[model samples]
Target: MTIEIGWKLDNSYVNNLPELFFTKVNPTPVSSPKMVILNYPLIRYLGLNVQTLQSNEGVAIFAGNKIPEGAMPLAQAYAGHQFGHFTMLGDGRAVLIGEQITPLGERYDIQLKGSGRTPYSRGGDGRAALGPMLREYIISEAMHNFGIPTTRSLAVVTTGESIARETRLPGAILARVASSHLRVGTFQYAAKWGTVEDIRILSDYTIKRHFSYIEDDENPYLSLLKEVIKRQAALIAKWQLIGFIHGVMNTDNMTISGETIDYGPCAFMDTYDPATVFSSIDIHGRYAYGNQPNIAAWNLARFAETLLPLLDENQERGVKLAQDAISDFGKLYHRNWLTGMRAKLGIFNEESEDGSLVEDLLNIMQKYRADYTNTFVALTFEKLEDSSLFSTDEFLKWHRRWKDRLSRQQESNNSSQQLMKNSNPSIIPRNHRVEEALEAAVKQGDYSVLERLLDALSNPYDYSIKQADYSTPPEPSDRPYRTFCGT
Candidate 1:
């Protein structure tokens, strides 16, 4: 009989690394813990024995109160370039409890963010504040519902005690699910400090776990690099189409699995501005919306540098191969970005002058300072008669161009309109609404607003019957929201 209560980690990946990189360590103890949100769908999707994972015993295991049988808990090691400067960071306040082979025959890493301190904790308390923890839970779940590839949140547990951040705040931990925690920086950590053998081992293991199909290729290293670039470009284009600003798109924060991993200071834009940035630390707007494509290419270059030693026997030949592989990221990113923008504008066929059609709509939106989400949503609904709905009169001129473009495409039919409505989301996690919901939950323990927000967000593409308030942009009084690092 298959056991339901205990879990075993078939840790084949650990064999590739030195023991010192992941010394089995216990989490720092915390005060009272209370369960907040549990992701039932994910628990089932992972094909975890539901009886044990959802039981009180399972809740205890998830909250870090109990480590199940055969669980090899260890923190992952990695170095990252934070903002513009390189720094070594690891699972400072997070821990990989174990790895599970899901029922679908896929493998996933089970990790706990804010679990407690580890060897990588850089002289500060390794606990997460309530705000950031909840922010991740909200945004990650919202992204999943929006059909974007992202790490899923399993459960949220609040520590009774408080941690000091901008203020004394309550602490919480999030059980996060991912295809794998191996990142570009994971290889960087080894290349910069560990031996060449370590980089070779990591490359082999990464291929086995993520790109096993490329193993037989004579040039496996170059093929792996190209695959990572392709996936990241597609992922970033999805982010741009949805108006997500990752706030911190550091090298270490990126996952090789192409999932949107970290959600720190991340926000969806309100106004349709290309230069929008909300992360408090982003003083120079280096990771702004318009600059994400360039930043992604830059990060891929760094990853390319780390993999150079393993790419060829001769150092110079390897460097040349890596540069050539990284050069393809731009072409792939533009192709994916344009394809997505075409869908958003209801264009089905590729035309030589499609760029002008797309660019003109964006220019109009910028000139009008329109609400990004609502503008696209309004066009999907195609209620051009209602002019007052737009924040500016510039939408009127754009409406004509949008209609002219739609007329050229086959999707102008009634059936096409219906399909676009399903493709385009009417509601998203508006920044102001998210802040309002989270504040209410934290301050008063009133989850009604959070519940309502989730209800609206669940059917993002569908029109809500009585939820007009949730769809509208926040008033002038709720203009700015300051996001903090969950230190």
Candidate 2:
């Protein structure tokens, strides 16, 4: 019997782009695949039939054991500056099945991560472990709930096979949906290796897909660069306002669509330390919480480099154009960050002293080693009496100043509080809680913990008694939280 569910797959990527962009490939089959979880909400969003996708055939498709009709699997090619060193990289353990056209007419790339080895698999097993796949699923969904731009997980299925990492771990495949997988590194690869015509074709295709509004500009490529810069600036500001450390902001991981991709070694900060880094590989803290804006600007500069030829016929003029556009990044980022900080602090109107007021609060938080999320939550709900740090003279003085600043706002006190409530999340995917849930699911085969954690994280801004259960920070005796790439 053939399984069919009216899959609306329109493979624009493979059809519209040149052969140099990707290589045709099929997912390597897995044995005895079992569905671990399914995102019913996402299923409906994509206009997929939920009942059909809940069947065994759907599990097989998600596990890379069966291919769906109209799916054209391929491994994309790209290059990246990993830790500031240029290297060619690509989809080693992932295969883009096809672009699914939703009923609303939006197209999304459906990818199977940990599907198997590809031409880009240099010298190792191109497989993903169960824990890491689940981690991405949890974190990505949490990020989405927080109103952040990110790739989303549609499903996760275990391979029923063990792969050796530091130890034998259960294998799994993640069904990831994204606006597109185009990255800054994709342009780098074309610029460094392919013909000039390849870049032009790619630029045109990208503009058509993501930035079509800019296609009519006199210099569409330059416009594309500026638009990317704007999106990335605002995106990084959002991350900073939430204490998110991407941990690994490699050129390959930075998406052209400005959506957060590749959830490797990413974590939200607990303590209010700007220098916090959770990736075990980030020994120098290059992608620290405070450094994300700078790194984003740096990556955009590299992206600008790829468009140098397209910017102008004269190399000097093109460089200048790219430089001028890149220079706006800091101001753009600062404006976004300041506006967000104002909202978080319950300031309803802009004031000259608002930046210093926000900085003073941060300085107190850092000096007292306060929990980042909780401190904001306290201010949002006026629960500062709960924390002893609020009793300190430095904090008390700062609090008085904050109150004075709030009085100058045009909005009412109630409206200002409502703004803060919306800005400050009551719950984040706490590092310790995430680890606990993963341990139970992976080691004990108990998903109840993971399910419950997901439920608590589903509505981050809603402050409820249930959310408080997962809001507690790690115990003092616990080891420092570290994350892996899970590659």
Instruction: Highest TM-score: give the candidate number.
Output: 2
- The C-alpha TM-scores of every prediction are 0.94, 0.99
Which pairs clash inside model 1?
none
| lDDT of every model, 2 decimals | 0.80, 0.92
Full-model lDDT, candidate 2: 0.92
Per-residue lDDT of 270 in model 2: 93
- The predictions' CA RMSDs to the true structure, in order, are 2.2, 1.1
Model 1, 1-487: lDDT tens digits are 1267435456655656786356576666566777777777787787667666666666667667777666678888899999978988888988887788776578888888888888998987878877677789889988998788899888888878788876898888888989888887887898898988888888888888899999999989888898899899998888988889998889998888889988888999888889998888888999899899899999999999888888898999999998888888888888887888878877777887778777877877777667887877777776644435454556666667667777887665675567567666787788888889889878887778887887787778768774577778877664465565666
Model 1 lowest lDDT segment of ten:
384-393
Ten residues in a row with the worst lDDT in model 2? Answer: 1-10
